[model samples]
Target: MSKIAQELASASTNTEDFYADLKPFANFEQLTNFDRYLPLPDDWFIGVADVVQSTRAIEIGRYKAVNTVAAAVLVAITNALPRLGFPYVFGGDGATVALPGKYLDDVRYELARTAAWAEDSLGLVLRVTIVPVSEIRAAGHDVRVARYAASENVSYAMFTGGGVAWAETQLKKGEFAIHRAPLDAKPNLSGLYCGFGPIPTEQGVILSIIALPLEDQASYRALVADVLTLIEFSSRRSGHPLPEGGPLPSWLGGEIQRLLSRDSPHANLLTAAADALRAIKTRIVLAAGIRIGRFEPSKYRREMWQNTDFRKFDDGLKMTVDCSPEIAEAIEARLIFAERSGVCLAGTHRQKSAHLTCYVPSNIQSDHVHFVDGADGGYAAAAAKKRRVRLPRGTNGHYRANRSIDAGERPHRD
Candidate 1:
């Protein structure tokens, strides 16, 4: 092992509080400051899960299904390892999570099961794998993480360094591959759903952007900061895609998807009826802005909007914003200029509106998180555009980043 890896392996054994113990920053811009991040212990493992042929799926108008399966990776792992607080990022078509070595077997099993479940239940192939942090260090990459507290009840994980991007590249190359479990295998996907309809743009359009540094990290950070400044200056809520009170749930948007994700292949009449009733109750509560038992609909709506992961940094910067045509054009022009100047590689996609997928562990809790993307194609399309650009030799290439929702220095306000 490398000397840094040796030190990391010996530095600490108390892994339970690895993420919980880190001091979190409230400002999202602090993500560009490397000092805010801490390196993971070498004994930790990074797990990656992604849907194969996602572009094909998205092309056929199954973006919501794609988002749900991607979110399922996080939901399943979070539900399985409830006691441990680990950092994870949600890419539009996949997710990346880091955990201690002790839970490797458990996580691997869950990932395998999740992959199998996706294939059997959702008809999407999920590729999953777990790699050791020490190996990553030995390969001259590192995984450094920071916590951005978007709200009191939720803090999203921000990842820096090149380690995450590297692991993903390896997974795509068929290294450290984890085979899917038996068809009967199921992951704990209790809280996963894509219940809301596509969010109509209040401004003009929904834009998804993915940008990565092509040169040094310093220049990249500066460029990202400038991009963020443009985005913040262009809109009231820093280009947040959701409305003030959060999105209204569609009458039967996610019911079938939820039923399909259950343990059984077929949902019986009673189970389907129960699920529909629950959906109806939820719609009534949110539509009427009423408090049912411990659940406060209005407060939940506000928190949900505040906690949506519309902008984030995994290995690089990824954002999905709602803005007018002028702002979107200006931002695109700036990125094109940056790409031409050899500062970064970037791609963007625009749609009529934005899509949301949720993992609400409970309706009453303020900690629930929602994932955002362009309703038409979102990050997947943006990434495809980015890939069309020819990368120089030794270029790190594109990798999916984290998905935790965070706010910038200017938090979204009603």
Candidate 2:
């Protein structure tokens, strides 16, 4: 074999044995350079969310609580973005998310809806505004900004309370009289408190929202659902979920805390921030998903693949995915009555979490997979990763057919 071919073969053999060890790239300057290097998707969808009147929370003797809630909201929004097929940024007081160009309308509706809902649910007013990229630059702000990549999260909600609502309603209703006409005198809110500027997205949509009143709650939810439905329909027509990253779980704060404590001297600084951030309602709602692997040594993990039957698929058979041994065992308990073999294997270490693969043999048909966890609902197989496939119960063929045939569909059933 050619040297290149041999090298490729050698690298392929070690793929499963490799996992990226990421440290908190917290240097703002380094992050800025990284942002420039990050090949952003063309025609992104962007939205800015920021808190309204967070100062009031501080004045009301809930300053610490407010900060915690703010961080939580940001985490929640950040977590949900991956699920919705968007890359997001967590500004200290707000967030910016970018969706694919094709998913523009869907993103617009869903983001707006989510922002509104987060406002009500978290008891914090989050204002979301959207604008095009042209507007972003026209306003003299660099829209491409970065927070702590892989480590930090962001959140915001709509405005509440009668006084704030009244003021916001008047603003929307053109109550602010100006020298220029209503359209001509649009307020330029750049770098305001808890305010987000314009955002550019992969989906031709650039959205920027400042403090907007949470007036007409029903209308906002309807708009959100409508946008989501549109996105779903588009996804069905295109047969994909506008591919992006995955949702993160909020509990990841704890994981981050542990990792920092174990590896870094400045763990205290980061941990304090993580603790305060996790207390926020938004982070709780939009946390990232991270699963712990069973406490097997690295050597044992390397050999785990040898025991599994990755190629065999029995008729009516399927695979169950779990985060840890306990989860896998619980799932196994549910499948006690199945007449086929059950194979459980350790998942690769990614980020801070581990995955488990379970081969379920059964007589069921239609080639579908089920996820029992609400947090990880509609889970799908990951890319560039080999997953075990359980074929129909009786056919018993090698599962080599699991090669990806479509953009979104992978070996795992959703």
Off by over 4 Å in 2: 1-42, 64-87, 138-141, 145-414
User: Can you tell me which runs of candidate 1 are displaced by over 4 Å?
Assistant: 1-13, 255-266, 386-414
Whole-model alpha-carbon lDDT for candidate 1: 0.78
Instruction: Name the TM-score of candidate 2.
Output: 0.29
Give the Cα lDDT of each candidate. 0.78, 0.27
lDDT of 2 by residue, 1-414 (tens): 733234324442322111111123443223213222221222443444444554444335432223323333334333344234233433223344444445545444444544444343345555554444333222221222222332132111111111111222222233431111121111111111211111112232111111111223233333323323433343321111111232222333333223323233455766766654653532333232222243222322222222221111111112211222333333333333121322221121111122122111111211111111101111121221343332111011111222212212212211
TM-score per candidate: 0.90, 0.29
lDDT of 1 by residue, 252-350 (tens): 657445555344757577777776677777788898988878888899999999999998877678899988889889888988988787777778889
Best candidate, TM-score: 1
